[model samples]
Target: MSDTLTTIGFDADDTLWHNERFFALTQSHFAELLADHTDHETLMQRLLEAERRNLPHYGFGIKGFTLSMIETAIEVTDGHAPASVIAEILNAGRDMLSHAVELLPHAAEAVEHLRRQYKVIVITKGDLLDQERKLAQSGLRDLFHGIEIVSAKTPEVYARIFNAYGTGADQGMMVGNAMASDVVPMIAAGGWGVHVPHGLSWEIEHAATPEHKRYHEIPDLAHLPKLIETLTQGQINATS
Candidate 1:
């Protein structure tokens, strides 16, 4: 793939390590805290609604989620969310912030392999400090050529980052778990988009898959190297 692909970007959260799972667990904790006020299903729906409303204001990360939980708590309980509940919510957010980084299966090896052949980078959207901390603990930091903690991953953002860090998005490839943030936008920016699914996904991140030739999906990160080789050979065949 070196002949056609110059850069490879990986999404740092669920794509590399355990991320959404923790969010799921935290949401569970949130539901429990508000059990007296609302049922689990109803609380989750309301929490999701608050997140949608506040995303533009707070952006993505534990801080935003914590605020959304508090907002939902207030709304569910008729604007009388308890001080102790708020305190526990803050505590849960802190726990999420300080959670240990656990690498996904084959995450390290896949990144190491790709970096040897391409300009491997991390293109993720989250709180900057938390992202930096996670990278520092991930043990895969040095394997990357660059780390991008974007507020959001849009087509323009992908284009700019790829051009600034490598050649351009056209010769770039991005692998991540979020179709909306990672795969679709990169494809829109004229790069190859590879989807690597995780067991848990946030509903807000869902989008209809783009019907594009450059889009591909792998069962796991371990398959990335082989996919690149196949694409590389196909590129050679087409050009020759």
Candidate 2:
């Protein structure tokens, strides 16, 4: 274990469990309800655009997600959707949003492994209430030493977290899913980062990767413990 890596931060949503996939499935069901007026792809695009517009108002959460689906459903339907279709859309969105909470495979094990040797912190951006509820439901809420639920994950956020934890850039590592929201800012803040790409990421987060030595990309949560062990081993070797 690396004594140099005193603190490690993790992303919550897609990093710890299934998130955007649920939204995508809900959106698919929602688009089906409005297929008479708009196709699924078009409906999804408009909803993404709408979400970009609504971010300032809603932050991040299922409430905003469901609202975006309803907004897009109404917009695409051109006011001609039957009450049944609208009800179905609402119910489907709500059902998915209220999805039974569970942890991703290996999330618990990886966290346990890291926590044994380092200060494990969760740095996630989302609606505070929704995030808290999910964390509570996932049954891993007690595992983390520090939790950062923020409105955004930017370089500033990374810097603040590093400073608060009293760790320099070399001693702090970030693990998250979105390149745009997670890796980019951590790199910009001069911190090391691990990218665990989700199966479905937001279109906006699909940006060109900036080259950096401290960045490591892994396939999924199952590989995380090994990756961390390797990185931590290197850090330990360097210090010793």
Best candidate, lDDT-wise? Answer: 1
For TM-score, the strongest prediction is 1
**Per-residue lDDT over 31-125 for candidate 1, one digit per residue giving the tens place of the 0 to 100 score:** 88899998999999999999999999999999999999989999999989999999999999999999999999999999988888899999998
Clashing pairs in 1: none
Q: What TM-score, to 2 decimals, does candidate 1 have?
A: 0.98
TM-score of candidate 2 to 2 decimals: 0.89
**Per-model TM-score versus the true fold:** 0.98, 0.89
Candidate 2 regions exceeding 4 Å error are 1-3, 79-84, 166-170, 236-240
- lDDT for each candidate structure: 0.93, 0.80
What are the C-alpha RMSDs, in order, of all predicted structures? 1.5, 2.6
How well is each residue in 1-240 modelled by candidate 2, as lDDT tens digits? 124667788898888988888877877777767777877778889999988888889877777777777777777777665778768867875676567776777888888888988888899887787788889998888999988899888888888987787475457888888888888888888877789888788886776776887888988777877876887788678878
